[model samples]
Every structure is written in structure tokens, then in C-alpha cells.
Target: MHNEPLAYRMRPKNIDEIAGQEEIIGKNTALYHLIKKGHVPSMLLYGEPGIGKTSLAHAIAGTSDLPFISLNATVSGKKEVEDVVAEARVTGKVLLFLDEIHRFNKLQQDTLLPHVEKGSIVLIGATTENPFHDVNPAIRSRCGEIKQLKRLEASDLLGVLHRALTDQERGLGKQSIRITEAQLLKIAEGVNGDARKALNVLESVVIASDEENGETIVEDWLVDNLIGRIGLFSDKKGSHFYNLLSALQKSIRGSDVNAAIYYLAHLLETGDLVAVNRRLLVIAYEDIGLAAPHIGAHVLAATEAAVRLGMPEARIPLANAVIEMCLASKSNSAYKAFDAAVRAINSGNTGDIPPHLRDTHYAGAAELGHVGYQYPHNTPIGSFGGWIDQQYLPDKVEGTEFYRPVQAGDEVKLAAIYERMKEMKKNKR
Candidate 1:
């Protein structure tokens, strides 16, 4: 039994035998229907580890009754890819599933495009990283994408454990091993949503049933793996990653300073610090603009300081920066107003920049008669833009208000000055 590979013996024989990933394996799916119609496209499946991507690909190949040639992109170079392509061309309908498909460099990935175009081989790829980030654009452009999700439900894990225990050939039926539900659930709870890890844990649990002499029993001192403790924290690059980050971003955006700091701490302790900094920078500009212009600057300075400080020393600066961003008065006025003005101009509002305000800092100034621009400060009436007949937002649309400012922090001061200037010009006109 030790000489035989566990995965080979345990691999699901058919789609019915496989568990999870019903999102892709369930009825009416593109892959399911295409296999039925005898017209399956080259596909790519992406998700966290132990989510059954390779199993699905193998099952698909079985349905076609064609030889499945599995390739690992990480090790295979361009020459190897070319050889596979040659074989595929000769076979005409073989299934080639490339695991870690994104690991293939651009040149290696390109080797498959021409062969794929000719339909010599059906290319199915499996990747762990987000396909949009990891896969070559050309490969993604040609293949339909199937995204697998991490194991979440404890019941789903229990299903795998039971199948392993009572599946006759696959389970412990070969030996006289008796186990209670408590021990099994403990192993299952420690599995961290990965079926392969769960099965491996079961094997270990059985082997150590009696720690001292290796005798069989339901009780033993079982050492927990890293994946086991991971289930306790709940975010070891799994489902909680996105949700946690989302809450962090919104915390800063909504100006909850304390909450933002708390989220930053959680990310630093459980997630990536660099990612937290990246989001903080975005939150600074996107959510807090001219109203609190210092927010973006503060975040950038904090990032630079963190890079210089490094590791343990960097934590305080990171927290301070995130707090600063949250404490900053919120404003999207500058961005919204700028976008509005641009939209109006692009929509065919070919207007002039009032002659009085046109660029006068040039060589041949007097020849152009660039004067009569009341410098507002010099005149009581202040002919701000010369004759008010000058167009600003085209003749069809005059008085298009764009830059409305929020009354907070620096924006309040700017808005007041801006309004006063606007009032004087409109009063004279």
C-alpha cells in the first residue's frame, strides 16, 4: 500500500465520483453541454489549491474517451511545448491540460496558439492565481474560463471524509480500523477546505492511531499541520481575503478612523502589508480629494517611510497613515467636477477660455491686443472675462455648473473664495 500512490487510487473515476465545483460541473455549464454536443472549447480553470481543477479536467477527458496528456507549465520550456504541439497535431483530438498554465512565459504560451487555432488539441489549463493576472492575454483570449472556489462548508468536508471511510476500496476497509465521529470531525475541521489535505490528514490519523507502538485505536496524540491552525484564523489566502480588504477600504472611505486602523492591523497580522498600503493610496485619492488633499500625500509618505523602516518598525507608520486617511474630511468633488467638464467638452462644447483669462504670458503680446482683461483686483466693476458675451460652455449651453465644492477642511476655504469671485463677475454681467 505504501508503494502505491494514494492520489491515483483515490482519484474520482467520473463526474459523479468527483465532489465540489458544482458551479462548473453542474448541468447546463458550457463544459458540460459542450462535451454533450461534442464541441468542447479549450478551457482554463483557476482557483485555490485542492479545489479539484485537475480532477475536473481529467473527468472531461474521460468523457471524450481521448488520451489526456498532462503538462506542468512550470517545468516545461518552449521546446517541450513545441513537442507537445507536434504530438497534438499528429493525434488531432487529444486532450492537453496544462497545470500551472500561467507559469508558462509569453513565448512558451504562444507555442500553443497556432496549434490551438487549428484544433489539433483541446487545451485545458489549471491555474491557482487569478487568470487575469497570471495567464497570457492570448491564451485567455482563446479559452473559456472556469473559476473554482475554495472549500467552505464543514458538511462538504464531512461528505469527503465519509466517502473515504466507507468507499470499500478507497477507505480503511482493507484494514481493521475503527474510528469514532469525534476523531474524524477533528481531522475534518482541521482540513482548511482542501480535499487533498483532508485525505492526507486522514491517512496520518490512521497511521498514528496508537502513537507509541503504531497499534490501531481511535485515540492518539495527533500533531496539527499549518493548514489545521489556518482554519482557526480563517484567512490564509482563502475566501476571507477579499471580504477583509473590502471592509478595510470602506473603513477608510467612510472616515471611520479607529475602524480603519483596526482593519489595517488585521491585514498586517493575517494578510499582506503591501496590499494594504496599495488600497490605502487608492482610498486617499478616490474617496478623499481636495476637501482633504493631504490624505493622499500622507499615505504616500507613510508608504515611503514603511519601505525605509521595514518589518516590525514599519507597523506604526502604516497604522498612522491609514488613520490619517480615515480622519481626513471626505470629498470626491474635484474628480467628479473635472470629469463633468471633460464630458461636456467632449460632447461637442467647443467653447473658448474667456479672452480676459486667455494666456497673456507670451512674446508677441501687444500685437494680439491681449488687454482689457480686468485683473479683478484692479477694478471695482471688474470686467472679469471682458464682455460677458464670450462663450464658456458653448452658445447652446451657457452657465453649466461643474465644480461644486464640499464645505469641509481646505475645500471650505477654497469654495468661499471661488464663490466670491463667481458672484462679482456675474453681478457685473
Candidate 2:
């Protein structure tokens, strides 16, 4: 048992023994009820890698004492799936754990539909990719539940490490290795919520330790040295990726240049140029909107340059863009106004286009009262330069104010001009 990797040897044999995902496996949770009743359904377990999707599937089968069959969709073909179905038929029912289910194409996924529907096979599919975007819709619909397993919390990972250290049959307990709580925590933190990675690093640290009188003492320095080799797994497709992206945008919006630059570097390290560019464009329009509208154009230019140049060199323009955005005055008035306008329209407040504001170029448009539209270009007001006091909105929304500009950055000048225009219009009225 010592020859096997610590992660594989310490696989939880029951639901109660599972380390993390309290939201999904805690008492009174849906998954908990399913396992307790021994009535496991077809479920799609989606989350980041090394977070125990396969282990949970095994635990579910073990709890029910049902026949369990495992397959990897990346390698399993039609014949392998047929064999599982045949075995299920003989056993009356079987728990089929298909890992990386997203790798299965449409036809491969379809093969399981009939058996799953017929109660011959209870499918427990696991995937890191989002099921909605990657899995076949048909197969997705058949899965009774789609439970999302979150990344294990730090404390939960610590418990897992402690368990491996004490379990004599399956873990390093036989080795008499002494490690401190703080040292264990270092391994937990370095893995970024991946228990398998934490266990592997712990095993390596123990194996490399110098033994004295059959007792191996794992010093902090030895753990630190081993940890340096294991890079933190940055899941570009998982929730962590979105969390980091959110942090970057919030940092820029909060005017923290250092934090914005740090997150930008992290994304660049992951080689997610497309996400970086998309997020920068969104931040410009959403966070720095109206206050510094010109930043949008500059952001686009930077994005273009980044895309053309690619990596190392691309980071220059991206860094410049991030710095500029972080230092600029932030506002969400434009975004808020658009959302408000959308809500009003969705609530059935969509008024008909005013006759004067309707299209007048097409033939017969004038017959429908589309004429008498005031051309602002032809009616310039004094000192206003090609501007005129005119009602552009429909009568129902004539006085509605959707855009309330703030007194920040370029919006200050815009607000002044808007107030001046309102005063001129009031006098004309």
C-alpha cells in the first residue's frame, strides 16, 4: 500500500469519509439523501480537476453496494460502453462512472441515453468543463442532477493532510514521519485546494527526508524546498479563473494599480490573452464609462496591439492599458443607464416612436406623420455650435432622464454642457 501514491491510497471509501464539498455532501444535502437512501441517480459532477469528483462517485457506489464500473471518456469507445451495458443487464443495475465525460462526442454520449433511461445503468459522469457548453444536451438532460463541486477550502484540505499522516494502513503513519501543523498548511496552501497535489507533495517531502533511528523528521526547510517544484495549478476554465478576473476588474475600479497589475501578470502567465483583452475592453466601458469615455478607444488600441504582437511584448501594451485604467476616474453611469433603460422597455414602457423622430427618408413615411422633424444641424443656437432645443424622445418618455452624469473626470464638462443645454431649452419652451 505504501508503494501506491498517497492520493490514490487515501481515497475516501464512504460519503462520511469525504474531505470537502460540505454544500453538496453535508447532512440533509440532496447528495447526502441520495446516498443514504441507496438510490443514486444519474448526476453530472462538474468542477476543477483533483477536487475528488471520481472519489465521490466511487463513494456513492460503495454506499449503495451497487456494481460499479469506471471508464474514461477520452479513451473508452463504443465497444467499452457496450460491455458496461451488458454487465449492467446481468446485474440488474450498475453505477457507471465516466470521467472526463466531455471528451465523448455526440454519438458516444447518445449510446448511454437508452440504458440510463431504462434504469439499467445509473450514470455518474464527472467533468471539469462546464456541462452546459461541452456535454451533449441530450445526455445533459438525462442526468437527473448537475451538482457543482467547489474547490476545497483551506481548512478542509488541512483535515485531509492530517488524515493521511495518521491513517496507518493507507498513509504515511507507518513511516513515523513528524510534520508540524504549520508545515502541513504550507503544503495545503501551495496546492490551491487540490488534495491530490497536496498529498503528492507531502509524500515527496517525506520520502526525501533524512531518517534517524527509523524516525524521519520533515523540517520546514525540506517541505519548502519540495513545494518550490510544484507550481500552483491555475485552472483557466474553472471558477478560480473567473474569481481572478473579477479581482482584477475590482482592483482597477478601486484605483489600485498594484493589484490590477498583479492580476494582469497572473492572467498573462496563464497565456489567456483573449480573456485579458476581453476583460480590459469590458472594464473600459463598464467601470471607466462616461468618466473617461476616451479610454475605451485607447483600450481597444492596446488590445489590437496585444493581439498582433503576442506574449512578452504584448504584456507591455496590456500593462500600460491596465495602469491607465486603474489611475483614471471610475464611473458606471453609462452601464447603469443602459440597464435602467432595458428594464423600462422590458416592463412594457416602450413608447411608440414620436412622429417627428420617426424615419422620414422612405417613401410614404411622410404620409404617416413622419415629417416636421427639426434638423438640429440647420438650427444652430447662439454659442452652442450646431445645437438646437428639440424633443428627440417619444411623448411617453419625453421628460424621462436615463443618463445622470456624475461630476468626475470628463463627465464634469459633459454635465456642465448638458445643464447649459437644459437651461437654453427651458427658456425656448
Which number leads on lDDT? Answer: 2
TM-score of each: 0.69, 0.79
lDDT of 1 by residue, 1-429 (tens): 555434455667666666766667667566667775667678888776776787778877777777678889888888888888878767776778899888878888668787776778788888877787768888887786556555645676777777777666766556656677776677767766677777777776677666335436656346354234444333545445665688988988887877877777767766476776787788888788888887788889998788788777778888888777777788888888989988987998666555555678998765676655644344343433333323344445577788988898888988986788678668868
lDDT of 2 by residue, 1-429 (tens): 457888999988889888888888887688798788988889999988888899899888878899999999999999899888889889999999999988887667667779998888999999988888878888788898998987787798899999998999998777788788899989988876888888899899988989889899889988888888464557786756876899999999999999999999888877889998999999999999889999999999999999999998999999999999999987898888889888888998778787888877788997888877777888776776688767787777787778888889998988899888788888989
Candidate of highest TM-score: 2
Candidate 2's error at 9, in angstroms?
0.9
Total clashing residue pairs per candidate?
0, 0
Q: What is the lDDT of residue 276 in candidate 2?
A: 88
lDDT for model 1: 0.72
Structure candidate 1, residue pairs in collision: none
In candidate 1 the C-alpha lDDT for residue 245 amounts to 82
